[model samples]
Target chain A: MNRKKLLSGVLAVCIAAATALTSAACAKKNNKDSGGDTAEVKKLFVDLHTLMPSASENATPDQPHPVNASRYIAAAYKSLTGTEIVWASDYAKPTDNINNISAWFNQQINIKNCPAIGFTFGTKMQADGLYADLGEYLERPNPYVAGNTRWKDIFEDWVWDDPAVTDANGKIVSVPIVLHPGSATAIYYNKDMFAENGMTVPTTWNEFIKTIDDGKKVPGIKYPYVPYTGDTGISLSSWAFRYSLSPGFAAHMADRTDYDKNGIVSTNELIRAVLEGAFNPNVCQEAKALYRLAYNYYKTVLPGGWESITDTTYLNAWDEGKVAMKNQGLWYYTNEKSDVIRKFDFDLFAPPVAQSDSSAYASDLPRKKLSEGYRSQVLISFNVMLPAVSGNEKLLEKAIDFLMYLSAPEAVTAMVQENGAGLPAVKGAEYPSVYDDSAWLDREFTEIGISEWPLGFIEGNTANINAAFSDWVFGEKTEAEFFTIVNREQVNGARTMVNNMKINTAGWNI
Target chain B: MKDGKKRKIQIKYIIAAALVSVFSLFYLFDFLWAKTYKVEVVSVSDENPVASNGERVEIAVRVTHFGKPANGHVIFALPSDGRMLAFTTLTDENGVATLTYIPYTANAFLPVHDVEIRIRDQSNSIFWEINAYTDLELKMRAR
Candidate 1:
């Protein structure tokens, strides 16, 4: 009986000891998880890219006035969360090599030290599982925001529905913080030069061409229309021309090309459409007319050495009053207004619409209107994303909290006011007063129903597209020859994309 | 002998239960009661008295809380436009955070202009404002 009592006592002691040890272990873990007593402030690495000021510019205060929008954001976030943001050193310099950034991010991911927040151009990284699935978190109320039911409620429904921010599985992978009315491209004309030439802003394609023709006769104007073609990717002019004119050519093909029926044609869907014989730029009359009309317009307005001039050269020429009109993004309006040394006044107008009389393929679609409330072509900017490879759930939670703070209406207003890049994506966030004089804000935008860039189908195909277009423009390749080369390349690119993505071809009917 | 052994066993059980209770209380205390401080900004001043447009001027801000310097607190220097002039910096041991600022030329005709220097805390809940005059013509000649 004594032995039995001793055994029971021993068992009770063991159970109690185990329970105590478990509680102690959990307490230690909870402390570390909450970072309750840690003296060191946690750090989250980020790459805000062009959305932030260059470190070199900001580091050396003697340089040109630097904008510290991202710094303010970081400071605000740290104040709230006690987490410091370490920006990537090379965040300001733009690189055409998307792979380099992707590779660096992947390497960081492997080492488990990936940046918590960064920008991405497309959903490729999201598909590779590099970006965290933000759908569930977005559905939950943002803790930092007061009276917010869902985090996604901060953004407009159109922005949240954009496929660019969502993956193939319809999971939200990125947060777009800025939206601009119409496409980013606009025609910036010299106000003085326009008045001197007695030409008003063109409302139709014919009128636009005529205005350019008239501007060419002006003595000092070296190039009447200077469209930036320096980028190895699609040039500003090329993108504008193709997208603006696409509706006239391919509006009828939307039913077949827009596989998901989202109104916007995705790159994958465009490839599939080409493979399935739904859109053949070479054979289809409307498609053929698109390239021909776009090419002809370029030939008319562009100078002889237009292909050789870089964006800097074109911008310098415009500033020097040598270029009468320049095609640029809406963000340039802020830049031009802020230039202290700028001597000439400038104004912007939307790309003129193509009337039915301009071509048989023209759809006679009324020019799309632009307003603070009605944004037709919503350009998603600053797509901030979280790295999925960061296995620390606590760190992820902190990063998400920082993001929530950034997406708040007040924070977004501050960001927009500092960056002066685009309109705020979050509701209740006010845009800068600089946009008060923006004529394009109330004018009609060049309507684009189906966006198509046929010259380059794959990543490295830009060179071929540029070359072919250059040769064709320089009278080296006939229109037919240009179409043939581009058509074959398009098919190969579609095939490559299909193979790489392992895209299901079950219902493609290809 | 058995009764004595049972009493000893009962004593062991009480000790074990006491230890568990102590541990549980400790865990709860650590989880529920952690220290947090309310930080605030104290003052802002221009370190350089004479400055010109396009020349880097040093702006310093002092931050403190409850009669003590708030070390490692982040502060920002901004222009009248409310855009930050430089990246944020943490307060040093003296509770002073300094940043470099270059005044921009608003107009060539009006060479001298007043620049409003706004200092903000990490939360931007409090602000301290100061002003400095910059000569654009002098800066232009120096350049």
Candidate 2:
């Protein structure tokens, strides 16, 4: 009887001890205060490290227009948690945009005090696994939202899952903040000139050229459309190409091509096709047509001295009302209202490239109307990257919280309103109804304008095409000569891309 | 003979104690392992933080899990009067929900009004916005 009593006493004691131990372990695992965790809440001090492209002539003489979202983001976390944010902009000046590699990876990645969140065009940091894989966090519900919605549900469909942010293994490595998919290749015209000239907005290609021809006689304006060709051969080619690469014409490749089939033919796929022996530039029907279109623009449509007019020259001329219209990108509107000379109102329209005569459709060029939004390429720029660092989990969490806050509908609306640029990547964002006395760009942009260079195509494609177009447009090369130059460049560009991709040598033609 | 009988009784006691102890351990496991949750809710919108009475203010409320979305039901105890518009709504998959409320009977920029919005099980005041003309509105309510 004594033995039994002693055993019972021992069992009860063991039970009590085990219960106590389990409770301690659970307490440690739970992210709650629970009486024992008395460590006072640590205030977060996060720095936003990023770079802004140096303005050509300074968009603002005394103060830069607010382009960074960090200012609005400053309020979001403060309202919720105890966080002190430092906006550390342009940390690496020299390497800010060194051919797409930013200062964040060039110098800041190694420093212990590097900004918590950074803006970069992908670098060794991302490709070499030095950046955090944001795949998990992007999926979690955003705390900034006052409802039970996951973060994954908030982003626009195409941008949230864009292939550009993913690595070779399909792991999402970054977050895309801005997707400028609309027409960068738009005609920002002097709306006052067009209005006074009694000219209606031209919906057809033939009508557009008529206005260009008519502008020469419109009292003050000398050139109706002055594309920025200057001494830069690349600029001329780009100017001509934007009007040439319509969606109807863009699908034709130099070699057989395979796009993402996500309905977006991004630059990454173009480069991949070039390297993988899936695309070749030499015999591409689209390339030939695009070249012809550029040649035609220089021959008939471009203003004289287009060979000499740098973009700045035309922009200055536009302010003085000397130039009536110019083919530029969406970036022109992002500048401050004070930057312009303010002689006339400005409006934007897509590049008009089709032949007026239905009979002139002898080539693979599109026979469709010019106003249709057929884009040749989709431009997805300015993604936010989170670098991989050790032992700063709390700070990292806070930075992510800020990013999520920026992705909200209200935040996106503010960004579009303040920055006056950048198509919001968040769904349900509001684009300002009007821009500078003119309406906003077409929601369904008319032309998927071609880029200046065949961006991310065969390696030598950019240089070779630029030279060919320069000689052709400058009256230095004959039609035969231009064709000869282009063919040679196409061959060389493909070979360069092959070497860059490091394909093993075989029976393949170089 | 007495000692042998005592020994048998002791064995029975030990067996009974062991069974009772094992059952107690199981009970402890169940108590600690079962899931339990309490939502933390807050206002997330910085835009239109202040609104006039009778002016519909879209109140955004979020139930969070440690600053992230907490997936669960959040029932709200609405103000009894018609002033509490859209008193019940569920957070979406991202822990975000928006409801429009008419806090006053008429629209005009008036004095500030403090409204304490609550989630039924203790937590409240998830969102606070202005109700101008509060005194006049209160007079109408009193009548």
Best by lDDT: 1
Model 2 Cα shift for residue B125 (angstroms): 57
**Clashing pairs for predicted structure model 1, backbone only:** none
Per-candidate Cα RMSD to the true structure, in Å, reads 21.3, 26.2
lDDT of 2 by residue, A1-510 (tens): 699999999999999989766644432322121112233223322332232322331212133332433443554556566554444432333332333344444444444334445544432233334456677888798886668367867766555334445533345555555545354456678788888888766544556768778887788886677763322443333534544433334543422333446544444444444445443334554555555655666676776656666667676777787777776655554441323235567667766554323113212333323125332231332333344233446545655676787667656555554344445566666543323223444334543322122333332354565666677777777766766665555446545544544434353332
Cα misplacement distance, residue A100 of candidate 1 (Å): 6.0
Candidate 2 chain A weakest lDDT stretch, 10 residues = A28-37
TM-score of chain B of 1: 0.45
For each candidate in the order shown, give its overall lDDT on alpha carbons. Answer: 0.60, 0.48
Question: Which candidate achieves the best DockQ against the true structure?
Answer: 1
Candidate 1 lDDT, tens digit per residue, B6-124? Answer: 99999999999999988777655543321122333333344332333324455566665555666765554545422233445666897776655544323211233355554545532
Q: How do the residues A1-510 of candidate 1 rate in per-residue lDDT, one tens digit apiece? A: 699999999999999999767645643443243332233336665656556545543322243335565676777677766877766543232333455666666655454445567665545454355667787878889876689999999887776555456654455777777776465667888898888778798877767778778888889987888763433332312555655555555665666677788776666677777788655666676667767777776676566656667777777777788888777776566456544334678888876665565678666655656544454434443333454325456666665776787778766665665555577788877665445546556676655544444444554454565567668877899988877766776677667666755666778777
